[model samples]
Target: MSDFLIDEELLAAIDMGSNSFHLAIARLDHGEVKKVVSMSEKVQLAAGLDDNNNLTDVAQQRGLACLSRFVGRLSSVQANRLRIVATNALRQAKNGQDFIDKAAKILPKPIEIIAGREEARLIYLGVSHTMANGGRRLVIDIGGGSTEFIIGEQFEPIYTESLQMGCVAFTNKFFADGEINVKNFNKAVSAATKELLAIANVYKEEGWETVVGSSGTIKACRQIIINLGWSDEKQTITRTGVEKLKEKLLKYKHISELDFEGLKEDRRAVLPAGFAILYAIFNVMDIDRMMYSDGALREGVMYDLLGRFKHEDIRDRSVQALVGRYNIDIKQAERVVKTAQKLFDDVAESLKLTNEDSDLLRRAAYLHEIGLAISHGGYHRHGAYVLEHSDIPGFSQIDQNCLSHLVAHHRRKIKADLKNEVLKVGTPALVYLCLLLRLAVLLNHSRSDQMLPAIELTVLNEQQWCLTVSGDAKQWPLLVADLHDEQAQFKHWNIDLIIQSEKFID
Candidate 1:
């Protein structure tokens, strides 16, 4: 909220797709976003990944060059108002962090690698916003490295899945040589169908009133079908249209020899591969017709940003749902949340904690004890696992990872290596947040509504934090022991957690 402007505010989203990187800049008018600027480049980040799942230097450089250009077009947007999300390629790359680290230097903001389901959710959001809302719809997005299938009514996704097959990835795997013979074409379709095998039965059973397609690959296919006069009068991609395209595709022995009217040069190479995927979906899912929508992930990201600015953050709703589902003690969670907020306020400036970081801390605090629902024994570990693995909409993988770290370390004896294992960078800052969470959890151990004494937390320095508790230390023996234990835990993390009762401070 601190970084957003209410009226005529500019918001931007960079969708780092495996095949292409896109930037969308928009201005919020009333409750809608009007397109301001859009830019995209074929980075083919996924194609650069080798067998070892590492992005080659060439690929990294290509990505960075494109990001630098994207940064130039973002001159008018504030850093906080922008969201950059990477999909399958970054999620699959073993050395993604290295690429992200390099790209961070050239980009305006940190790149968030989203999970597949989150991608599906956002894709649905984008599609729903731009399409007519009535019946349940099935949306498909064929990306460079992954394909997302989502079933939803209006904006809410009922079923979301991200399969490990995409146009670019499939091309590299099955059609790397650009040959389009029947053997290779069948192989690609069969492979995609195999991946869909798991979800086909369930999705078909649930059904949908309409089928929609998004992303560049789908858009390209739709245009090619229409241009070739393969589609129906409404320009919808029909089963007959797809079958005709497939028949035309197998005629060419190689991709290079093929030429179509509406297909662009940049999209020509991957068209066959993308078409194979689309054909497979049609056959496997029993799809009769599909309509294309201009809205996709970037548009969804813009809408999500608008929601955040309007205090309708979906992540908060996600946390609340988790809390309720786990049957967590609401009063106790509030206690920890309130205390964590107070502690965060005290050291926010000193620790350079941004509003987003504060939000993460608060959400982590509320869900800290969610693991108790599983077992009180090692509940922290269970909680961490849940937060790390659960499909919570509106939360990116990074957000979930940070929350998992805070929850994992909230009540445990600080393992010296835990800090390094749980965090790659920002170890100190995360450890500090973890320390605050531990203190809040410790202070609320009693879980009573009794009034707490005035407490003040101060940052004496990077390695020292002083807490003053205005109460009779003798009366709160459990709290005193808890504080002492926390002091030792802080020490393990190389922080001096000093505490003083009113009398001791005096």
Candidate 2:
């Protein structure tokens, strides 16, 4: 069995945001998360993004420096128990891979760049966990490069959306000179309004009992209003308070000149842009008041990690939803899954595959035939498209892409180009998993529940492997022929796949 350990005593989550990087360390106590440590730094990674959407060297350096500090505190955390998630900046950066490679050297774990909707889901999760449980609530988080809005009840999010409007991004777009004039502020508001147009009607129609705001921008804004005495005793962000703040912002020609009691020096640069987005949200969605929530993406990730260890993985539900959506052949999927599990178990330790790898393989096996629902011809490609494009809540874009590659190449001719593509993300290990999946699918070609020969796999090295089946050679000529084809396929990837029967080896 593959050896992987989770630090049940402590869990850590890192949020590599566009504007800042935050780390939260916590321990689960009596079914509750007790935070032990927290750290944050304003890296402003998004502000360094160029016209081509590539992270500048300066931004990469800042991110690496911050993560290096975070690494120091993670010495005691288990690799499997910590999750580092990146938001819009990394998602938009063309040089994200280079940055990630640099960060890998300093971090205990690899960085996972989540999709927009997934970020929204996590933000909602964080907010829900911290806030009182009940009623449908609207949660908004304005990050450095993107903004996420979620509508959820208790611990479940009913709707989530992420828009390409954020403090740093909007500041760069409309307030680059640090000017806070009426015309520029109105322009920023208009830009933000346009971004919100797509979801305004739907959010308003669904309605929410409470309006909540998360992230630094919203928190800072709420504090500024409270300090200015614009808000009443409740410390709620009201529509009039926002208007008053906007009026004060309009009076200042430059952001540097605007000095409020609660606004910090670093936040002044992006305050106008953030406020414009908030103003647009209020106007478009008709929000009367919004309460700030201390929870956010980092907290959500910690809880999510906790859930995974608890065997309440949301990804499993996501996979099941995909299965039901496509009307897949359940029996065939089970057959492939059973065989995949057996093969995985036999060589997991020898191949150095982790439980995560096994889970990915099993999920892929279950959904491999989903594309067949679309068309008999090129069904693999169809399935890949669906998996890649669909909004799977718990899976990251990388996870979706990984599944897509496996599904696309499961049955077809294994092309060198495809292998290279999978290598870019999956590495050689994932290719091994894919090969295992292919063998399982091949073994279950009949798609019947009939008992098959016991099969075993042995991994001698990176590029060599063997499979042994417990049966007579003459009884399964078709299976023998398929194994020979698989052997040739593996040969293209420079892997020697040896097939053996009870008495003979081929």
Candidate 3:
């Protein structure tokens, strides 16, 4: 139950997809992931949405029930080792935070609702790792409320897009009457193709050597294709097979009469609409065949978690890219990060922090000065603005919010009125983190290579902390003055910041 007794090598990922919820538990073997167990449930969380994008009571119950089952299976896993991600449904929901709050009670970890582009990236990562290397591979993942299309080479993605078209949404919109007529099918296909038109030209120009598909819809498509003798026994869906299936689909005028050998009972209702979308994709994108991949978002999440543990963090790369784009001073960032980390280590144990917390602080330190590229006056607020609004890859909304909070308060007078807004979500952690970062920035006020005095941080209690500085009193008057000002900021967060100078003490 404790952090010390937990095994960091065992990782789990829960992908709360629109149509289904998938859980994958894996172990880190050398550098690769070896799957130990996998579980899935047809929660169809996306289909439970009402007109206003609020999940219905029935839908909430179904999702929670599925999660409860998953939680039982994850009894042995630690919270930090697990990553739970919600997709399109949660992203579109009006009262999403309400649902998240309820789910958090049963689940072992917090849920992260990833953006559409992020979903596309992770899908490509999942598909790319599962398939053999090709020059450029196009990955298509058709879910309940969204479909992600990505073009990538090896493990890196070049073009990523997520369309609003999905099986469940399309089915509800065009085929909810269950009339499998040519008219309805054409309408659905035309609508889906229209969405693709914007990306078609560019995607065709970029091109791909192979096409791959993931998720339940595509998997079911491949199964039906093989069962119908449209493809070889290998179970891969081909362009020719798709055409044959489309011809057969048109023959049935209604969903009730449509009984296919390979189609499962659960997939029957949505198959007609899903097929129309796929057929349109094949026609529009010139996809001849798409190899199916077993791995998708859940698998990618596991790999991403493993990367964090191994120090090959994508967030770090994202930070570097941000710095390069804004032309930030690398030396200044390094100076700040070095000082911030030293101060962080001094108070980490007393503050009851984790390595993840330390990493986030280091990243915040690196990016704290990014807005100086815009203007020097009130640049802390500007930096926070950029981090909060910009879509930095490999970071969730919550991650951005936390980073922005740190940058925003890095130098400002911590106001009491703003306390509830920032601390409401991050609570005591953000308060403590901001204080530590402020002290670090104050200590490095000169921004020079001159050695800093040996400083030790101690927490007398949750609301009281002392900084013991060992050096000559006259060495740094500016730093002492800055520290004195920082104390006022700490008082706003109810923390009494005390400074102790060894030379003056004895």
Candidate 4:
């Protein structure tokens, strides 16, 4: 038991939400997360959006300050054990990269701004973990700028949707003056219902056995319902409770004077608007009652990080799914992957590369010919375009760019313009990796199991690389021709590629 528990190490997650920032530290006990500590601050980063949809300077400063404090407490956690995620606020910000750069300087880990559907998937994971044994569960999370709806069985999400309606954003639009009335409340709820209408039909048809809510808004709403005596002691927010809360909230006519039994001071400003959104969701989606879940996106991030270490990486699954969807050639991909790995191992130490670099080489090799599915002519460009533009799950924009560069130049004539662009973003390491990938693809061009000669790669200096092939090189004339062609490409990048055979040795 002690040995098993030792493997279940401590994990931490930071959720930089639109409305708030949260940090959670947990320990895995019997496959369940036991919360050790947690912290949250009302950042309202989404509400700081300027007219151009960029995060305001004040908002960026506030976010950075909060992350600095969060980083202080995360001193014990390793970079790999900690996961940071940004939500709708960063997603909407045109200057998101600016803020990300500032935050990365202060935080212990890099932040991943997940896509909306991915957000829905993680929300369901968090909700499902906290819920009791049940059939299909419908999970809804109303954030400051977006709301996520998901239906899942056990731990796997089946349906996920994200709608652009939330507490803070709605408040700014409908109740920014702090005045709340029946007409304004109705307008807000109507707007929320309109957004839900897009997915309501599909979710209804799919159906669910239970409904669960997560995040600050839902937690606050549940408390209000229980304190107002509208629901039972079990803490479930019922439809009747939501309706009554709306009626009571409308009586105030202003957010400042709005006093509710369970409303916290921090929640007072967004309460009316959040309640309106919840009311619309319940009415539109026909939710009878929703049990609250303590687990949310941050918990899901930690769990996902754990999975990566345990070899259940979603990125691997996503890559396989892409291959299956594109109908890529499995045998050819395996051949390329094998050849790339073999070359990578030979020069990796001399190249000063990490395991991650090796992994990147393998993935690029596997998907190199994916563009051939589009067209045989200039498929490398097509593949690069797809990778750069496609919404590949589990891949960041930077990750996609790196993969795109590798695939785009794998077999092409490396032009002067392409060399400059590659040099701008990557170090010598990337250049070497790209060279290895190109050589591997060239070697496997025949795509047959004829087994070529054992090749050795040596880095002579920053400006040159050498490949020595030993075996019956004369038997494969095409292989020899490809190597000669690759030499021209090496010249374009200011590197020399030398192919040595027994003839050269003699």
Candidate 5:
């Protein structure tokens, strides 16, 4: 029923959620994301996690099969215009990379695993766009592997968290036998409440003016409650409605026995666990009522992609935030950023680099000194840790991981083992980017307004680079020595750095 040919200006996002895989291909109409075609399949990937936390082969097959189906739907979309993101299930899986590798074979783009807080941030992004300027709001999305809680104004999230509580996970944990009894139900509720303990006080203190729920679980609950006449149509999910739903759910002998008016067939099994988690949230957060939002993570990913196309990227904001929070030397950072940009521009076409790669180098330049906020010693390692662990709003886990490596090796003695790891991800020219940042940093070591000598960088091959130093060659002794010394470090990563200069080196 949907045609991409009708709309060339389209953005596509695939949400590889724990319980489902969703695809939304949308085009911008009047500055709003309008879905040309949206599809969701109940892959239930969380149910495939073994006791060892490895994604089982069957589960991977299920996910891959779903993606293969989605590939047909995505035929009209360019690979560059699409984003694929996996949430908590894959995040918790030991063999997540294994799954992603297989998925990479069929999907338009490689799947990106987002951190929990980043997940919360995107979920809030989607919800905020759909709301009608509704004051401060608390948005909750319960997936199969985790639950996201976000409190934000219209577009800015004040607090965000992805708690380890979800329908599929809880069903396996608390309702394994599928016994529809009050004891099992209460156990799930209590477990959810315990999970919320750390975040409850913060959400309450930061307090939202209204509460909104999103994703399949909440949508199913709202539908069942409103259809059953437990809650009026005006109140999709109220405390009273949830309590009544729980009472009715307990009346069933087993999960398969659930037969509510508006309950979908697929949601029947996970309903009890989802309801329990929602009930716990209601009790812990003291919520009297909640509204449902149609927007969610996939929608959020689409909007984020659209923003990047519009040059209103949130990752830029994140990098600026890091610079300010860590009190990075702004002038020094600017120098490195400018030099890095120039170097990247010089070697970009030769190395098949992209705008995304350029952006990565620029962001890493800005946050290179982020670790100085902690301590001057091994600040590079500190910055890497922060980038890897911190909730950078618009960055995927892979991007953070790449930036971490770039920052980690920017000024260090690139360890042999780490060098191998860096080389393993050579597609984005990460090693070359590291080398460029190092050169940029080295060239700006003086940290003064005095302009450094004009230098041009060119790639000789995958493993070789050439730097041509021009301008006043007399002021190049210390810089020449620094560049000479950095060459050995560059060689450590199996990259050859050839320096061309006149009358400066001994």
Candidate 6:
């Protein structure tokens, strides 16, 4: 295969979980993602955290080494075709960015640390793709660092949440000494129960006809129950089997003494804690049984990447949803988006802007007035906060921040500190996108059905640019004054902005 494929193309997604790191490779087979390869390493990244939640050097080394091996498997994968995402362990680490900095030298692409809710969304997507047309399924995935609960139908999730309790984290809290007594086991269950309590009622209200368990912990439990002859139904986990396993589990005082058929040696250490969490879920939500799905986070990611390449991006849906929810002026938004896109096309090559940056500019233009829904005073700041905090389905945390910065400075004086935040995205394109959005909004200040005259943007050089408004200058007094007023802002931005009308000269 070539570096990039037009058909039957290979797409990849890596899930850097708290307990294990996984890489899944697939190819687009008639608009569906078919698996090519699946690989995972038990790096125990969550266990590597010190008391202060800093990832230890030893843990970082373990993760880096594993990633090095993964890179060997990805030699044929194109950089743009791969997506790497980190879950709760990285999110909780104090020096997560420090670790990401070092890993950037090794991986094919930069790592995206996703928010908790976003993680749940992807997990649901993965489970939905591999399963049958089971209506209203509740999926629960137990990982090393955190557990995700999602109630979704088909590919869309109805409710998604990530709880802080996970198998590895619980093991550290209640089973650190390797002992698994009734006291400690119940305590672990109780703690997990407490974590689920907050969301139990809402999930219960939004009931599901079927339940699914995914990832390492639940998979191991299903296997162990079958191996121990506790469940006659080999593929399913039953309530009776769980009770039998619980009775037998408490009989052993330590994890080392407990052995069941089909249990992997690697999962031995965390199995007890994993069982406790599952037990809590079974009781709290009154679940009868849950079918296990082999697919999870990584699979969902590949399918999502497939959507982006096909131009059916969920981010577009998210933006449109906000527009409808806020009752935004659709006509006005369309005007700004059209002008912003033209501006981007004019200066894209000179500024080294990519299609992604152009997309950001369009989305920002449409959402610039989102804050007016809350309050007219400092609405830009309010809009920024909304973007930063809203759980838009497909946006990564950094994606939200980038959009937030653009919306925040659309009309007001651009803050100096914003440059630093923009740089964290590993791009200077945001600086240019911010300018394009600002000018687009300024051009559409009239918010009239009558279209404005033809506007042209030219890049004189790297540090200089000119906006030439065509047609009669006398008719555009408000826009003319706005352009002149923006001159001082340009003076401090290291760019010489020349704004004038074709009918006149500056």
Q: Can you write out model 2's per-residue Cα lDDT over 1-506, one digit (the tens) per residue?
A: 21322334778999999898999998777766778999999999999999999999988999899998998898777788899999999999998999998898888877889999999999998999998757999999999999999999998899999999999999999999887788888899999999999999999899899999999999999998998888867798999999999888788889889788878888889999999999999999999999999999999998887778777889998999888999998889989998999999988888888888888999999999888888999999999898889889889878888898888888878976677888988777789888989999999887777778778899878788989888776766778888898888898888999876655445
lDDT of all predictions: 0.89, 0.89, 0.84, 0.84, 0.88, 0.88
Local distance difference test, candidate 4: 0.84
Judge candidate 6 at residue 430 and give its lDDT: 82
lDDT, candidate 2, equals 0.89
Q: Find the candidate with the highest lDDT and give its number.
A: 1
Q: How well is each residue in 249-312 modelled by candidate 3, as lDDT tens digits?
A: 8999888887888677778888988888899999999887888998799988877776676677
In TM-score terms, candidate 2 sits at 0.96
TM-score of each: 0.96, 0.96, 0.93, 0.92, 0.96, 0.96
- Candidate 3 runs further than 4 Å off: 1-9, 232-235, 502-506
Per-residue CA lDDT of candidate 5, range 1-506, in tens?
12222334778999999999999998878778898898999999999999999989999999999999999998878887899999999999999989888887887677899999999999999999888967999999999999999999978889889999999999999888878888898899999999999899988988878899999999999988877887766766899998888778888989888888777888888999998999999999999999999999988998888778777889999899888888999999999999999999999999887777888899999988999999999999999999989888898889988899889988967765776687655454787788889888888899887977888998888789999888656676788778888888888777788988675454
- Model 4: lDDT of residue 143: 95
- Give the lowest summed-lDDT range of ten residues in model 3: 1-10
lDDT of 1 by residue, 343-380 (tens): 99988898887788788889999999999999999999
Q: Across residues 265-318, which tens digit of lDDT does each residue of candidate 4 receive?
A: 888899888889999999999988988888898888777766666667677777
* Winner of 3 and 5 under TM-score: 5
Off by over 4 Å in 4: 1-5, 416-432, 491-494, 504-506
Q: Which candidate, 2 or 3, would have the higher TM-score against the true structure?
A: 2
Off by over 4 Å in 6: 1-6
Poorest lDDT segment (10 consecutive residues) of candidate 6: 1-10
Off by over 4 Å in 1: 421-427, 504-506
What is the Å distance of residue 32 in model 4 from its true position? 3.7
Candidate 2: clashing residue pairs, number: 0
Model 6 pairs in collision? none
Point out the higher-scoring one by lDDT: 4 or 6: 6
Candidate 1 has its poorest 10 consecutive residues by lDDT at 497-506
